[model samples]
Target chain A: MSRLQTRFAELKEQNRAALVTFVTGGDPNYDASLAILKGLPAAGADVIELGMPFTDPMADGPAIQLANIRALDNGQDLAKTLQMVRAFREGEQVTPLVLMGYFNPIHKYGVERFIAEAVASGVDGLIVVDLPPEHNVDLCDPAQAAGLDFIRLTTPTTDDKRLPKVLNGSSGFVYYVSVAGVTGAGAATLDHVEQAVTRLRRHTDLPLCIGFGIRTPEHAATIARLAEGVVVGSALIDQIANATSDAQAIDGVLSLCSALAEGVRGARA
Target chain B: MPANRAHGALLPSFHSPVENAMTSLRTGPDANGLFGSFGGQYVAETLMPLIHDLAAEYEKAKLDPEFEKELAYFQRDFVGRPSPLYFAERLTEMCGGAKIYFKREELNHTGAHKINNCIGQVLLAKRMGKKRIIAETGAGMHGVATATVAARFGMECVIYMGSTDIHRQNANVLRMKLMGATVIPVVAGTGTLKDAMNEALRDWVTNVDNTFYMIGTVAGPHPYPAMVRDFQAVIGKETRDQMLAQEGRLPDSLIACIGGGSNAIGLFHPFLDDKQIKIIGVEAAGHGIETGKHAASLNGGVPGVLHGNRTFLLQSDDGQIIDAHSISAGLDYPGIGPEHAWLHEVGRVEYTSVTDTEALEAFHICCRQEGIIPALETAHALAEVFKRAPNLPKDHLMVINLSGRGDKDMQTIVHHMEQQEQHA
Candidate 1:
């Protein structure tokens, strides 16, 4: 089994939920983004979702959108984002890294070449927010061939009838959007998250990572009690955006990561 | 909430599988969702149920005799379908290569062929009891068409356009606004056609129950390509009858510019069986093919899924859709319709690229010679005629689908001309 699968299995055994933190690669600078990524695991992050910036990000909320704008302003493209991941991978190999972004930049980069590059860069999986499961055949086949997981997202609005098709095809943990709206919009209601997770569990045995509108340690803790993982994206990126310097940004993300991780751990204990 | 719950259950099966599956499969998107390895329903989980519902509904509706009767009535009364096929006698003689006929979609009520598809879709939406109609546009042709139909049907209309497009295509935007339609500017994603589509998808996702996304072209998921093509077949149906009467024979060549490729498909569908007649689809090569600035799908694109269906798309190595550029805003799209992709792959149609300069030259040539100023989108097809005319014998006939008039593009063309003179 791959390291992500192994890590997920271990987390399940320990009755602990994984903490996934999202940050835009090259948001401020490549080196700074690398530093932040390298620091995340030690700061209590179990998985790092490195965002590949694009000109258009339709599914992203304000925080991640602004973060992407900042990244683009700094001249971050596909090659640069992959290079940053490679840089982070040099020092840290254990923490599973998921490359997250819209599909345009990747499509511009040839699919086969991207899968090869992603595998070479030690990317464990991908979460193309806009790439629906129906269109994921191109990415999923190559990813599976490369021994990399093609993570799929299941939302509350996903019809129960079609849930099995999405869940069965997906590998790694299923990234379940807790709410119907875009990322960073509102808090995921506990009942809604539970219902979605329960519905998904009926379809697949894959770990479920609940995300979108996840803010505060309490929210993380509450989600941890029900799901296999809790992804803190817009909240962490918002923290990074407010920080003054690279060191300050890393510090802010680390603290938030620690608190969220501790909250999840506390729930497990 | 209770009503919505009931609607949800009814909606899922609204497009009955048994009825739609056969016809839907006959189109580009196969049952497995491969449109010659291009079109598939690549959408979010939240939208799947709705897309499935729409697909099923489209299938059932297509077979429903009442739906067909209603669509036929609207096509005749509203869109003025069976639009004439005028022999461009003056221009044909001036060119002196082949007989040329123009499929007079320009004579349609809205002065474009877009209303044909809009009338059909709006009628379907009304039958489905949808309250609001939302659409996206680049050159505002589709928006104007959608707004016109919505007004006739007395439905709330909302059109999303790129802010950049709104500024550049101000007259069409104003026309839409004046027609009791809310024209919302989409400021994201380079502020262009793709952005407008994204915004429309978002609106549909948020307000799916109350809204009907009147996709402007033959692109999008399964039912749309087939539905739009069915609506547009009127173009071909008229041309076929007109050709038999006027030319005494089938035309040797048929040409149309491809944006989302609805107009081209409309004209191309009826003739797909006639293998002798050459069907040429001209794509926009913005600067030139070599400069990496173009929307020439067959030349520069790979088979991939975007929006909702598989088609030829301009994308990078990683499968992210690249923004396409063309002087004609209508043709500024990253991908073409799934059927076009299938047709190109199957060699049923011939695809070529037309540069901005060539299309503009043709635009001016037609304006000066024929006294007909065609939209830049149509100019792409006109460029093909210029290229093909020299190769063909004098006896050969070429019929071009003059999909729209140039009224919507006057300001853009004038501004472009001023810029060119300034540079010179």
Candidate 2:
């Protein structure tokens, strides 16, 4: 099994949802971002999503958009992002790490080179927001063939007709974008998320992760009861955006990850 | 598939025996929504089902006579279709090499070819039972056009314009507001066309239930590029009929400025199968290509995906999209439409660039010679006319898509004139 599958299986055995913590790679600066990544597993994060920053992150909201700009301004490129992954992997294992972002940076980095380096750099999965199943041959098929799990984001807008197509080649956990809006938009109702989870359960057996509009531990706890994993991106990245220094950025993200994890761990208690 | 040509040259004249032997360039973007490897539905999965529904609806509307009748009604009576293809007597005399004709898209309602697409999209929105209309604009022509159609159709309209563009194009902002559109200024990413487009996409993703995103140009995912091209093709169709009636033959060449390439594609698509007419798309070179400050994607860019399609984009080596600069807000986009990228790659269209300086000169000349104030975006195409017209044979007829009027561009032009006077 892939690292993602292994992690989720362990989480299932524990009867708790995985706390999927996300932060942009090299945000604010390289050292601080690497510090946050290295501390995530210790901070109780079950899965880590490192954002590969691109200038035009159209799918992101203000919080994550600012995160991408900060990462890029601090001279973070694909090469540095991969290097950060390698460094994080030197100290960390078992916790599945997924690189999430748009497709252009990967395209420019050369897809083959990106997949090869990602696999070698201890990257386990990808969550490309702009790459729908329609163009799966471009990246998804190739990456999956190379043993890298290709996660698909199934939104509220994806009806029953489209759900199977989205889940067909999907590995890792299936991401349920709880809202029809961009990242960091208003949270969906628990009722809406519940219905979506039930519908997604009918489609595929892949573990389902819920993201978008998830912020505080209370919200994470609420979603943890319904899905296999809970994703919090902008909420954690906001910690970096609000930090006075690199040390605070690392502390802010790790501490929040611990708190969110605590909420997810005790949700079923 | 047509046999690939070595250069950006047409196959042959339409009557040639080779014409039937080869495939048509018009048939493109196979089932996967690709024009070669350029165009595709690269949007988020949230928008995919909607895009597919739109494509299906568009295909149905293309076949339905009722839809055709309604579209024709709006085109003829509302948006003023069949904008004249007038022979530019002064421009032809000034060039002293070719007979130049102006495809006067500026005379359409809302004063640009943008209304052509807006009318078609608004009608589609109504057909889809959408209650709200949203769009992204750069110079505000498209915003104003979208606003106008939305008001006419009695729908709630919202337009996203870049903060920088809103400041530069204040007149268009007011015009959009006067038409009842809520003009939201996007303050992200240098606050330009691409940023506004990003915001608009966000809006569409959020309001996918009852909203229609009437894209202003021939860009975006799948059906958008092809649909916008079909709506704008009225320009080429009219020019074909007008030129044949007036000059007794098809024009030898066609030229238009390309930002997202709506106007250019509209004018070029009908002629793509002609196989003899030369097609040229002029991109805005804000400074120059060498300075790395231009928006000439084909000239100074590589193939990459953005705004839901893979196209030629001005991006850094790290794949960060470099901000594109142009005096004309309409042309200040880092990427070209995916179809244009395909055309450039397949050698069906020659793409070039016109610096801000050259476009300004052409703007002045067109105003002085034709007594017509041309949009700064249109001026880029005019600049190319000045370059190529003077070298072609006297009987070599040329059609330039006068894509918009200069009314919204007066501020930019005045600012440039002031700068020139100060430097002098």
Candidate 3:
């Protein structure tokens, strides 16, 4: 079985939803970002999505945008993001890692080289926010050949007809956008998320992780009841943005992740 | 985990819906948004709701006879469509090469050709019972058009413009304000056209229910590119008949400046089947092609998706859109319309770039020789005539699309000239 499928199977057996944590790589500083990534699995994060900063991130809300700005200001590039991922992988094992961002940097790096470098760095999946399933055919085959899952996002707008296409190409848990707009724009609606997740269940057997607008423990718990995993992005980045030191930032993220995990566990029970 | 099962099972099912939709739309030349492998609806999942909604609405709107009649009335009465094809006798003689004719879109009511699409969109908004109209503008021509239509229809108008543009094109800002449209100055991300679009999309998402987004160009997702093209088809319709009557035949070449490519597409659509009529599109090379400052989409851009559609865009290695610099505020956009990308790929239209200096030269040449001050955006097209005129025999005739007048650009030009004088 693939790493994603194996991970999902284990989670299913345990009757537990996965805890997905997102952090902007090189945010605050590169060393701090590396330390946080190394510590995440121990702090109850089952999956880690390291965000590569871009100049104009249309899908990101204020919190993550600010985090990305900080990262870019500190000189984070594709090489730097990859190096950080490599360093994190050296000391840690078993925790699945995904690189999530826009497609320009990857396109610039050359798709084949990017996939090779990502696979070498122990990246299990990728979620390019701007790459839709229709356009992903070019990247998907190469990524799959490299044994990396090309993760896809299904939003409220992703109809029943389009869901199968998204899921078919996607390997790692499908990211269900909880809102129609950018990340952290509003509160997660359980009713809408439930409808999306229920609809998605008919199309794919892969784990479904609800994200975008997922803020509090209550929000995570509500979504976790229906979803196989819950990914928190803008809220965690917001906390990290306000932290004075790397340790303080990691501590805050760990607490948030733990609380969210507990909520998911409670809902599962 | 095998490829055989995945591709085999999925290919058959996927082809059906896409094929059905393509057939319903009667997509010509390009196969299902192929556009010779350039145009497609490549957008994020979040934008699907808006894209689908617009596509469904546009499909129904296109077939509705009442919608067609309302659009026609607005085109005839509001925009004064079938705009004159005036012979630039003095300018043609001065050029000393081809006989030039100007498709005087500048004479359109409220100024510029922007109202052609604005009138159609506003009428559609009214039919949909939309209470508010929101738009993004760079040159303020589109903002003025949208605001004018909104005022006529008694609907609220909100226009987002770049903070830099508001200062550079202050006259247009003032005009929009006087027209009772709230002109929101966007402060983020290079403070230009792309930023204005970003702000507009945010506003649209926030007010999706009661608002109609009056996109200024033949860009954006599925329905927008096709919808705007259909509305602007009046330009080509007028040019075709007017040219036949005046010149006794179709002009040898048709040229238009491409911003988001609305004006170029407007002129190019009717002549698509002519095969013999040479089509040319001029892109803004702000300083020079080598100077790394321009909005020449096809010449200095790669394929990418933005604003809900796949097209040629000036983007970084990471896919973030770069800030486009041009003398003309209207042409300062990173991405071109998807159809232009298709045209470039298929070799249907010969795409080229004009430097800021070359455009300014053309601007002054037209003013001195023809006694007409063309918009900087249109000057790009005029500049191309100079380039082609030197190579062609004197008998060759070229029709240049005089998209808009230079009134809105006076303040910007004055400021630019002052900066140049200070440097010198």
Instruction: Give DockQ for candidates 1 onward, in order.
Output: 0.38, 0.92, 0.36
Cα lDDT tens digits, model 3, B328-391, are 8899999999888876765667889999999998998998888888899999999998888657
- Judge candidate 1 against the unseen true structure and give its global Cα lDDT, from 0 to 1: 0.83
Fnat per candidate, as a fraction, reads 0.50, 0.92, 0.44
Best first by DockQ, ranked: 2, 1, 3
Best by TM-score: 2
Please report the candidate that would top lDDT against the real structure. 2
- Compose the digit string of candidate 1's lDDT tens values, residues B302-416: 8765787667788765555678999899999998998888777666678888999999999999899888878889999999898888667888978899999999888888888
lDDT of 1 by residue, A4-113 (tens): 98889888889899998899998777777778888889888988899998655666666887888788777788898889888888888688999998765776677888
Q: What share of the true interface contacts does candidate 1 keep?
A: 0.50
- Which CAPRI tier for candidate 1? acceptable
Residue B3 displacement (Å), model 1 = 52
Better of 1 and 3 by DockQ: 1
Our model 3 lands, by Cα RMSD against the true structure, at 6.6
Pairs clashing in candidate 2? none
Error of 1 at B78 (Å): 0.8
